[model samples]
Target: MAEEDTARHRARMQRKKAVIEERIARASLERGVFLLHTGSGKGKSSAAFGVLARALGHGMNAVVVQFVKSRSDTGEEAFFRRHPAVRWYVMGEGFTWETQDPARDAAAARAAWETARAALTDPGVALVILDELTYAFKYHWLDLEEALAVFRARPFHQHLIVTGRAAPAALVEAADTVTEMGLVKHAFQAGVKAMPGIEW
Candidate 1:
C-alpha cells in the first residue's frame, strides 16, 4: 500500500512539473515593473531592499531615496552604500511628528523627490527604491499627480519599488505589483523592543 502511494505521488509531481514548464515556456513578456509595498505591518521597506539586493546580484545599478527616515543606522543602508552601483540618498529631515513643521517637511519631501526623479530618468539605473515615499504623499508633503508623472516617465526598462504604509489609491492603481502586509501580531505589542538586523 505504501509503495502504491509513493508511485501515485511521483506521477502527480511529474504532471505538475510538466504544467509548470509549459506555463514558463508560454510566458514571453519582458519589461520593468512598478511594485508597491504598503500596510501598517512591518517589512515593507525590507522587502523592497530584498529586491534591490537581487538587482545588485544581477549586476544592475540601483538607487534608494529615503523620504521620511533620516537615520543612518540601518544595516541595509550601511552595506549597500559601499557598493559603487548603489546610489543612496537619505533626504528626510525626520518624521513629521519629530519635525513638527509642515513647511520644512514639505521642503524635504520636494528635495527627496528631485533626487528620486533623477534616478528614474537615468538609463543606467535598473532599480529605484523609494523608501517610505508614500508618507510624503499621504501627508500632502508631495503632490500625488507630480509623483505619478515621474513614475510614468521612468525608463521603460527600469523597475521602481515604493514602500510605506497607507499607500494612495492612485499609486495602488499605477503599480504592476502591489503587496499589502497585513498585521497579525507584533513583538512590540508584547513589549519587546525592536532589535538590530531584524527591525532595522
Candidate 2:
C-alpha cells in the first residue's frame, strides 16, 4: 500500500510539472509591468522593496518617491540611497493623523506627485516605486485622474510598483499585476512593539 501511494504521488508530480512547463512555454509576453500591492497587510511596502532590490541587482536605474512617510531613517532607505543608480525622495510631512491639516497634506502630496511624474516620464529610469501612495489618493490629497494620466504616459520600458492599502479601482485596472495581501494576524495586535530592523 505504501509503494502504491508513492507511485501515485510520483505520477501526480509529473503531471503537475508537465502542466507548469506547458504554461511557461505558452507565456511569451515580455514588457515592463505595473504592479500594485494593496489590502490591509503589513508587507505591501516590503514586497515592493524586494522588487526594487531585484531591479538594482540587474543594474537598472530606479527611483523611489515616498508619498506619506516623513522619516528618512529606515534601513531600506539608508541602504538603497547609497547606490548611485537610485534616486530616492521622501516627500511627506508625516502620516495624516500626525500632520492634522488637510491642506498641508494636499500640498505635500502634490509636491511628491510632481517628483513622481518626472520619474515616470524618464526613459532612463528602469523602475519606479511609489511607496504609500494609496493614502494620498484615499484622502483625496492628489487628483486621481491626473495621476492616471501620468501613469498612462510613462515610458514603455519603465516598470512601476505602487504600494499601500486601499488601492483605487482605476489604479488596479491599470496594473498588469495586482496583489492583495490579506492579513490573518499581526504582531501589533499581540502587543508586540515593532523592532528596528524588522519594522523599518
Candidate 3:
C-alpha cells in the first residue's frame, strides 16, 4: 500500500476508536435487559438459544419455554437440557394449522405462560428465553396487558429474550433491545429442503 493510503486508514481507525470508546464510557447501567427478536426471517429462536448458551458458559441459570414448537427433539434442547442449570419446556401441541383447535391452542399457551411465570418470578434464574411467544399475542391467545404486567414484575436482574414473528407493538416498546431479522433470500424458497441439524 502507498504511504498516503496507509496514513489515511490509520487516521480513520483512530477516529472510529475514539467514538466507540466515548459511547462505551457513557453506558454505565448495570442490570439485565429485555431483548426481543422478531421478523419474517428465521434464526430468532436460534439466536436466543445461542444467548442462553453464552449465559450458561458464564455459569448463569436459564429457563426456556417453547410456545409454538411441540417438538422436544431439537439439537438445542438435546444439548442444553443436559445442563443442570437449564430448565427446558416444550409446551405446544403443534402449529395452529396442524392442531386445528383454537381452544386447545389457547389453553396450551396459558399453561406455557404459567410455567414461564414460575421462571420469571424465581430470582435464581439469570436468563429466560420465551421462544415463539409472539404468536400467542398475534393470535389473541394471550393478553398484552397481562403479559406486560408480568414482564414488568420479573426479577430486575433477570434477562428476558422473547422471539417470534409479528411481535406486538406494545411488547416492542417495552423491550430494552429489539432485533428484526429480515428475509433476503431463503433456500427453502428455492426448493432447498430444511435439513436436519440446520433447521432444528
Candidate 4:
C-alpha cells in the first residue's frame, strides 16, 4: 500500500545519509606530519602560534621549543606557558647576532634541539612547534641532517611545525605542508624598532 512505500523510502534515505556522513568523516582526518612556515615576512611565528592554540583548544598535547628567541619577555610566552595542554621550553639564549659568540650560540641551539628531539619522540605529544628553527640551521648551529631525521622518526600521529625566515630547501622538501610568506612591507625597513607584543 502507499503507507508501506513511504516507510521503505524513509529507510533508504537514512542509509544514504549515513554513507555520506561516513565519507565526510574519513576525508576530514588530519594526517600528522611535518609543516614548515617560512618567509621574509612578519607572521611566520604568529602562524605557528595559531596552530599551537588550535591544538591546545582540541585537548591535544603540544610542546613549544624556542630556538633563536629565548628572552622570556613576550606575552605569548607567558600566556601559552599558563595553558595546561602545553609544555614550553626556552633555550634562554637570545640569538647569534645578539650574542656574537658562535660557540655559545651553537651550545644553546644544541640544547634546544635536544628538547625538540625528546618532544618528537614522545607519544603523548600530538604537536611540536619549533619556533625560529630555520635561523639555527641557517647559522649552521643545528645539523640539518639530524633535524630532518628527527622529523622523519616522529610518532605516526605526531605533527611538527617549524617557523622562521628563509627555510632551508631541504626542510621545505621534507615538510608535508610548506607555507612561504612573502614580505610586502616591514616597519624595520623604515628604521623603526620592533614593537613589544607585536614583534616580540
Candidate 5:
C-alpha cells in the first residue's frame, strides 16, 4: 500500500513539473517593447509606480516625470526623490481644472515632454514612467506625432509606462502590452474625501 501511494505521489509531482515547465517556456517567448497605458481606474499611476519600484529594486535606472498634480508632497514622490537610482522630475502644475489656463498647461506639458523624451533616449534609463501623460495628449497640449516618434525610436530593451485616464487609440495600438483598469467602485463617489497615502 505504501509503494502504491509513493508511486501516485511521484506521478502527480511529474505532472505538476511538466505544467510549470510549459508555462515558463511560453513566457520566455513573449517579448514586449512598447507603452503600457494603465488608465480607466484609480490605480493607473500606482501600478506604474509598482513597476518603478521593481526596476529600482533590480538596480535598473528609472525616471519618473509627473505631469499633472506635480506636488512633491506625495509619499511615493517623496520617497523616490531620495533614492539614488531614480531620477524624478515634476512639471509642477496643479490639476487642469484648477489651473483653468490652457496656454500655461500646454507650455508646462511641452516642457515635461521634453524631459520625458530625453529620458526615453538615455541608454542608462531602463524604465521611464510618464505619470498623467495621457492627459496632455487628451487635451492636445502635446503633439501626438512627436510623442509617437519618441516611443518608436526609443532604444531596444527600454520600457515606458504611461498612466492617465482615456488613453488614445493610436497609443494603444502602438503598445505591446495594454492594461485597462475598469472602475468597479470608488469611495470618492460616495462623497468620501481622499486621504493621503491611499488616494494621493
Candidate 6:
C-alpha cells in the first residue's frame, strides 16, 4: 500500500511539473511588472521592500519614494540606505492625523511625485517603490489619470510598486499584479505597541 501511494504521488508530481513547464514556456514576453499592494493589513510596504531587496541582490538600481511616512529611522530605510544602488526619499511630513493639514500633505506628495517621476523615466532605475502613494489620490493631492499616464510611459523594463490602504479601483485595474492583504488580526489591536524593526 505504501508503494502504491508513492507511485500515485510520483505521477501527480510529474503532472504538476509538466503543467508548470508548459505555462513557463508560454510566457515568452519578459518585461517589468506593476504591483499594487493594498487593503487594511500590514506588510504592504514591507513586501515592496522585500522585492527591492531581491532586486538589489541582482545588482539592479532602484528608487524608493515614501509618501505618507515621514520617519527616517525605519529599519528598512537604514539597511537599504547602505546599498549603493538604492536612492531613497522620505517625502512626507507624516500621516494625515499627525500633520492635520491637507495643504501640507498635498505639497509633500507632489514633491515626492516629482522625485518618482524622474525615476520612472530613467532607464537605469530597474525598480521604483512608491510607498503609501495611494494616499495622494485618496486625499485629492494628485490626479490619478496623470499618474497612470506616467506609469504607462515608464521605461519598458522598469518595475513599479505602490503600497497603501484603500487603493483606487483604477489603479488596481491597471496593475499587472494586485495583492489585497485582508486583515485577520494585528498585534496593535491587542494592545501591543508598534515594535521597532518588526512593526516599523
Candidates ranked, most accurate by lDDT first: 6, 3, 1, 2, 4, 5
lDDT of 3 by residue, 58-87 (tens): 999999999999998889999999999999
lDDT of 5 by residue, 1-200 (tens): 69999999999999999999998888765332665756567788888888889888889888999888768788898888898989999894789788999999999999998999999899888999998888998999998878989898888778888888888888898888888888888999999999999987
TM-score of each: 0.92, 0.95, 0.97, 0.83, 0.86, 0.97
Model 3 stretches astray by more than 4 angstroms: none
In model 1, which runs have C-alpha deviations exceeding 4 angstroms? none
Residue-by-residue lDDT tens digits, candidate 2, 101-194:
9999999999999999999999999999999999989999888888888888889889999999999999999999999999999998999999
The worst-scoring run of ten residues by lDDT in candidate 4 lies at 90-99
For model 5, where is the 10-residue window of minimal lDDT? 28-37
- Cα lDDT of all candidates, in order? 0.93, 0.93, 0.95, 0.89, 0.86, 0.96
Local accuracy of candidate 6 as per-residue lDDT tens digits, 96-177: 9999999999999999999999999999999999999999999999999999999999999999999999999999999999
Off by over 4 Å in 4: 1-30
The positional error of residue 9 in candidate 6, measured at the CA in angstroms, is 1.5
TM-score of 2: 0.95
Instruction: In angstroms, give how far residue 142 of model 2 lies from its true place.
Output: 1.6
Q: Point out the worst 10-residue segment of candidate 3 by lDDT.
A: 191-200
Evaluation by lDDT, superior candidate among 2 and 5: 2
Work out how many backbone clashes candidate 1 has. Answer: 0
Off by over 4 Å in 2: none
Position 48, candidate 6: lDDT: 99
TM-score attained by model 5: 0.86
Sliding window of 10 residues with minimal summed lDDT for model 2:
143-152
lDDT-better candidate, 2 vs 6: 6
Query: What local lDDT does model 5 show for residue 158?
Result: 88
